[model samples]
Target: MTTLHLEHASHAHIHGPACGHTQVPHGDHVDYAHDGHLHREHGGHWDECEPDGHAPHEGHDHRHGEGCGHESVLHGDHVDYLHDGHRHAPHDGHWDDH
Candidate 1:
């Protein structure tokens, strides 16, 4: 089994999204907060995601460039995500981005 360690180059704990942006995967619920990739549990085990890019919750098969979720941390000023080994802005933040 692949032992995946969940971590980051830098870890900043934000109480909530700078803006009101939020992402709730189906049944999952979330409050405004720092955005971090989640570690999903599947069949009493952890999933080994592709080394090329990120993955969603277990049981869902998604590939790079194929409807990959544009999940981001409302960087307080804008919405951005890490993809292709770099951070990118997905949208221009406004007052009512919630």
Candidate 2:
């Protein structure tokens, strides 16, 4: 089972191949923001299978190379505020502290 946790602001999306289920961690927040209040996010689907038609238990490369099927976040109009592994303050229109 491969678990991937993605969080942005109060939104989050969790994906894995444990029970063949891919669920968004945002829960009720996703439903409430369905009326175009938020941007429509897209992501890649991760599986527990390898290229050799076997389970990716060990010796599997999880790199961000081509064909690795890695998910990435793309920021469009909104300011991308990533607070992973660090703390950041909300600065209007500027991400860098000067």
Candidate 3:
């Protein structure tokens, strides 16, 4: 749970259900998908939301790699694959929801 102090959106840009961006639930907060990253409201600005820890996505068999047919999203130091409207990242030996 950290706020990207250097990266933020315009204070005038309010994000909501009709903001046109996808809303992603992150732990106790909600993040908005903008560009290729997730943003959350912090104070008067939008901070980049990078969730720590991984929640294993059970029943996942398909391995996501270089040509796995899923859209790759650069999440912090790792890459996450988008599958069925959710993001998946490789964990210890399985895929974790990012």
Candidate 4:
């Protein structure tokens, strides 16, 4: 068991979901940044969701920025995380594209 904290590390949208991309869904622990919130792996699966409707995590109000290239901007409940200079969204199993 590992306890990881949030950091300003950028995650390319390409490293995100595979609904329409080549990247596969996360099987191991994968931390995600969306809408100023962090959804990490807790308990047994990636059940630590942080959608806008869900309660916000304390002291979690910072974006990971564009370290992986392209910019990430907040877009309503989901985030328009960019990759390859194009806007892309991560696949949170609980929600679809909005």
The best candidate by TM-score is 3
> Whole-model lDDT for model 1 versus the true structure?
0.35
List candidate 3 stretches off by more than 4 Å: 1-37, 41-44
**How much lDDT does candidate 3 score?**
0.74
TM-score-better candidate, 2 vs 4:
4
Model 1 per-residue lDDT at 27:
26
| CA lDDT of each prediction against the hidden true structure | 0.35, 0.26, 0.74, 0.39
For residues 4-55, write the lDDT of model 2, one tens digit per residue. Answer: 3332344444433342232222322121112112222434422222112223
Which TM-score value belongs to model 3? 0.57
Model 2: ten consecutive residues of lowest lDDT: 27-36
Task: Give TM per candidate.
Answer: 0.23, 0.16, 0.57, 0.24
lDDT string for model 4 (12-37, tens) is: 33324543332212234344544454
Clashing residue pair totals per candidate (backbone < 3 A): 3, 0, 0, 0
Report per-prediction Cα RMSD to one decimal: 12.6, 16.5, 4.5, 13.1
Across residues 1-98, which tens digit of lDDT does each residue of candidate 1 receive? 12344433333333233544343221232333334333233343333221233323333232323245755544455544444333343322211112
Question: Which residue pairs overlap in candidate 2's backbone?
Answer: none
Q: Which candidate would rank higher by lDDT, 3 or 4?
A: 3
